[model samples]
Target: MSSGTAAGRSRSRSRWRAGLGRLAAGTALLTAVALLPWLSGNDPALTVLRARSADQDPSPEQLASVREQLGLDEGPFTHLVHWLGGLPQGDAGTSWVSGEAVLPQVTSAFAVSVTLMLGALVVTVAVAALVSARTLYLGSRRRLHRATGAVGVAVLAALPKFLLASLLATVCGVWLGWFPSSGWEGPASMVLPALALGVPSGAMIGGLLDQSLPAAFNEPWARTWYAYGFAPHHVARHALRRTMAGVLPQLLPTVVALVGGAVAVEKIFNIPGLGRLALDAAIAQDLPTLQTATLALILLGTVAGLLIQVLRRALLGPALRDGALPALHAPAAFRGRSTRWAAVACALALLTLVTAGLLRDPLHVDTAARLVPPSAAHPLGTDALGRDLLARLGHGALRTIGVAVAVTAVCTLTGLLLGMAPQVGAGLTEVMSTMPAVLAGLLTTAVTGPSASGAALAVCLVGWTPYAAQAAALLEQERASGHMLASLSFGAGPGHLLRHHLLPAVLPPVLRNALLRLPTTVLVLASLGFLGLGEQPPTAEWGRLLSENQPYAELAPWTVLCPAGALVLLSVLALSGTDAAAVRSRASVPVRMSRRSRRRGVQGHARPAGSYK
Candidate 1:
């Protein structure tokens, strides 16, 4: 068979496999949603009754009638079948809390969410394109500009979405009066939220494109086109397209993240989108609404994934068919000494806070000194309940940072293990990547009840997918490298190759990515807590502290600022540490290569060093 024809057939088979995998994942998700009522260990009818009237003591007959009305008395199989049957006809049942049709509510909210997502996506693409173009214009000679761009992008990406939302809402909305801070009034209100969501994500995409575009420009095809006397813009356009196609797969997870991150943004901005609806339902224990919302989100995510896949294929076209594209390499790191020192300072400050807080009592309430400003006794001030803000923040750090670290560790390990087998791991990663950590938290809260552990578990459930995807991609690149191919020619076994080559090659970069993700993990945990799906009040958690003190910001800004500031500092530390590590890793590569060359020379088989160049 011709190579092109064989490649076409291979793509066809891959599509079939992907279709099957998506179908299986959809079925599993639907089944889980259908069984959520039962999984929560709460009577759906009783829960509905409580939501309807929190003070009412319901009789057995009332509960039974409610169960019958909701069709929850039936087995899960029957419910699943009924739900599936209704989906084709747009029948998504009724909301237990609001007593409204679930379909209309979910659809309306989903439309709003889709609008927000589209707006954010537009911003994401625009920012990425602009940044990439600017970086290209600067070219390789402007190392300082490139370094500044990298740090700027990293900082933007590191900023928590919720924090950004708050800032934009305050400055742009409230202060400047450029936009409304709250409500889904119209397109005008969307500006701030879209910017909040898109800017960070844009920086992330821009960073990727900045790295990829330069590499793409250096490609043989790109050089050939340039040598053909093509217009610079025309050549640049083609390079951009090719670079996007190469990086498109990485954007799928970003889409998933955008959807998930919307939860906090919606809440902060008071946009009645699906994320807010799902969170509300989860909090209210409105199983019917929560289940329907969860399923809708899943479908939306699946469709988005499919769309991205189609776009990627379209962009690649002949290159994909001919298998001409090379596997992407990790971006080179730029050293920034200032960022390193800032990270160290942040870490020390945080450690000092945690150590000091641990030495004091967080829960000790003194009503006489309520809402006190920073004094000699209270370093950070006091909350409304007269609890020392410093004490709470210190103790909260342990809960927040400790949990984040643990989750990051688990995700990294899981990713490393799964990434060893790219075929299986990549598929699984794609499947899980569709479910955002927020949605996962909602589902987890439904099953396990709202707590710190549930929030952590929810994060762990989907968090590893990103790391796994990164590892799988790295593994693919390593496997396709000349060294690995040469080793295979020398009869290296799979075990030997995996132990000596793949693991060593993939581990460091993936670990650095995980370290970079630490702040994000903390953000996610805090988001869950902010939504009341994490640690409840009376417990010192950063998110819970924010949620509780938000209303009292004017009264005692310290209550809000302390935790928020801590989170911001932590984010800075994570970004700086990861970038520093990347620089160190990159710096060592040449030294290691030279040492290997020396060893080869000692073996009397090394070629002239000049030959390498």
Candidate 2:
């Protein structure tokens, strides 16, 4: 009875700590938002003046007047305090550019975003449920079918949201005229954007459930339920609840990601949401509007996270009490030879493309042959500048792939290190995770101007957060495992345990997670490039290529197709290769474990004979 009380108290304290951490994080982020105008180097007063009247040359008096009106003369702290003070009164200040109240604008935009998010979330749940049901139906009876479905889902998830949005708009909105491609006219308008956002996210959620549900059914409770002659449907329902108890916690990060990802989606769909508002404000250096929009997004994430937590607890209270939660598992490796061979083929194709590109001169301009189609001489054709498409692609691959590899390595190492100290890392990760790469890029661009390096820096800043979160969760799980507890009871030192137990157990999954993130990193980098925040004109980067050639897409289709195809291939390679690599890595784990055990035994025997005796 005392232990139960103690446990309850512990949980209560944990909840308090979590709440305090969130409050602190939100405050710190708002404070940063307040400082953005100052950090931007561009004078907000001048920016506002130009935004209001682009052709007018503002004098010092006008600038000073604008600054005084906007309260920019004060420090960031004052701005933050004022903003906070006004929040209770529903005041969010006035936009410098528009001279309109920020709150109403932000509120309206936020509502639209919320609606879109809810729709996307519904689609996500539906996809996850459908995928999970299909996986279970096939069960052990149709391994091939399950594997193929899983692979298809993975490929679907690997698709960049922008590409998906474009396809949906073209096919459903433009071609079929079933839905409006742009604008928020009615409920029908939301369908395409929701599907574009939800399908990929749903595929991800479905994949996660696909992994966890099988493991849940393998649990002893499931076996007991079967032994008791429970209906199959009834047992499956119970098993799903058990699986979700573990899976739901993982979705918090996904929720944060979904909000962040909406920035691009909103822009593509022409939705008048907070994402679009924020983007426009950022571009215009409209501090008041940008800050309010950013705060709204952060708040949305926090609220969603809270609701998810409440729902999980309410629905899975019995599972929680019974301590029947499963440990988060690494993605299962591909078992089929067909999947492995496909991965290999993709790698070879990519290598050949890169190799062939290296042998050509990407920069040599041939204006005479500009916009040439694929031919014997120019295999992938020439762009408007008459540069060989194949050569640019080859050279661009080096830049894109090199940056991704370097960033992934850094993120992996940083996450592992930070994850080792979860006590200090968790709150920090939470704060950083809420700031998406797009928002980070905007901030970085404000300070350093948009460049490839600034985009890379932006990605690096937020990229580590997901990895760190994963590492922290995995470390926590491992620390609570039976083997880890046994080692602790046997007097294993911290260093020994970390080296032989914790790291070995944690590294595989984290590394695999990083490997899986390669495509995302590439996509993020490309998105920034497409936004003109990455490599500038004359650069042959894939995203830049896409952005530059988009205007001429109908005229010179090859220009767009070449780069788009490259990105798709890379995505496929990363997704398929991760699975193949996991297989090899998992197979080698037992050998590595055996060797470590042998080393430990030898060390035990080699210790000074009876030193204590």
Q: Write the per-residue lDDT of candidate 2 for residues 1-613, one digit (tens) a residue.
A: 9989998998787667667777787777777777777888878888778888894689999998988987787877887777778889989888878878999999998888778877888888887777677656543222323244555655666666776787788779988999999999889998999898888777766765665555445445555665667667776666566556545645665667666657777877788987778877877778778888878777766776677668876766643454333243333443556666666777788899899998999889998999999999999998888999999999899898888888888878887787677545645566667677887887888778889889998888778875676666556545654445555666779997776667655676566556656766877888888787777768777777766666566678798888777766776566566556555655664466557657655332121211110
Candidate 1: list runs displaced more than 4 Å. 2-6, 97-99, 126-137, 142-146, 149-154, 207-247, 283-288, 313-333, 416-422, 425-427, 473-492, 496-509, 584-613
lDDT of 1 at 100: 81
Candidate 2 all-Cα RMSD: 5.8
TM-score, per-candidate, Cα-based = 0.84, 0.87
The superposed Cα distance between candidate 1 and the true structure at residue 231, in angstroms, equals 9.9
lDDT of each: 0.71, 0.71
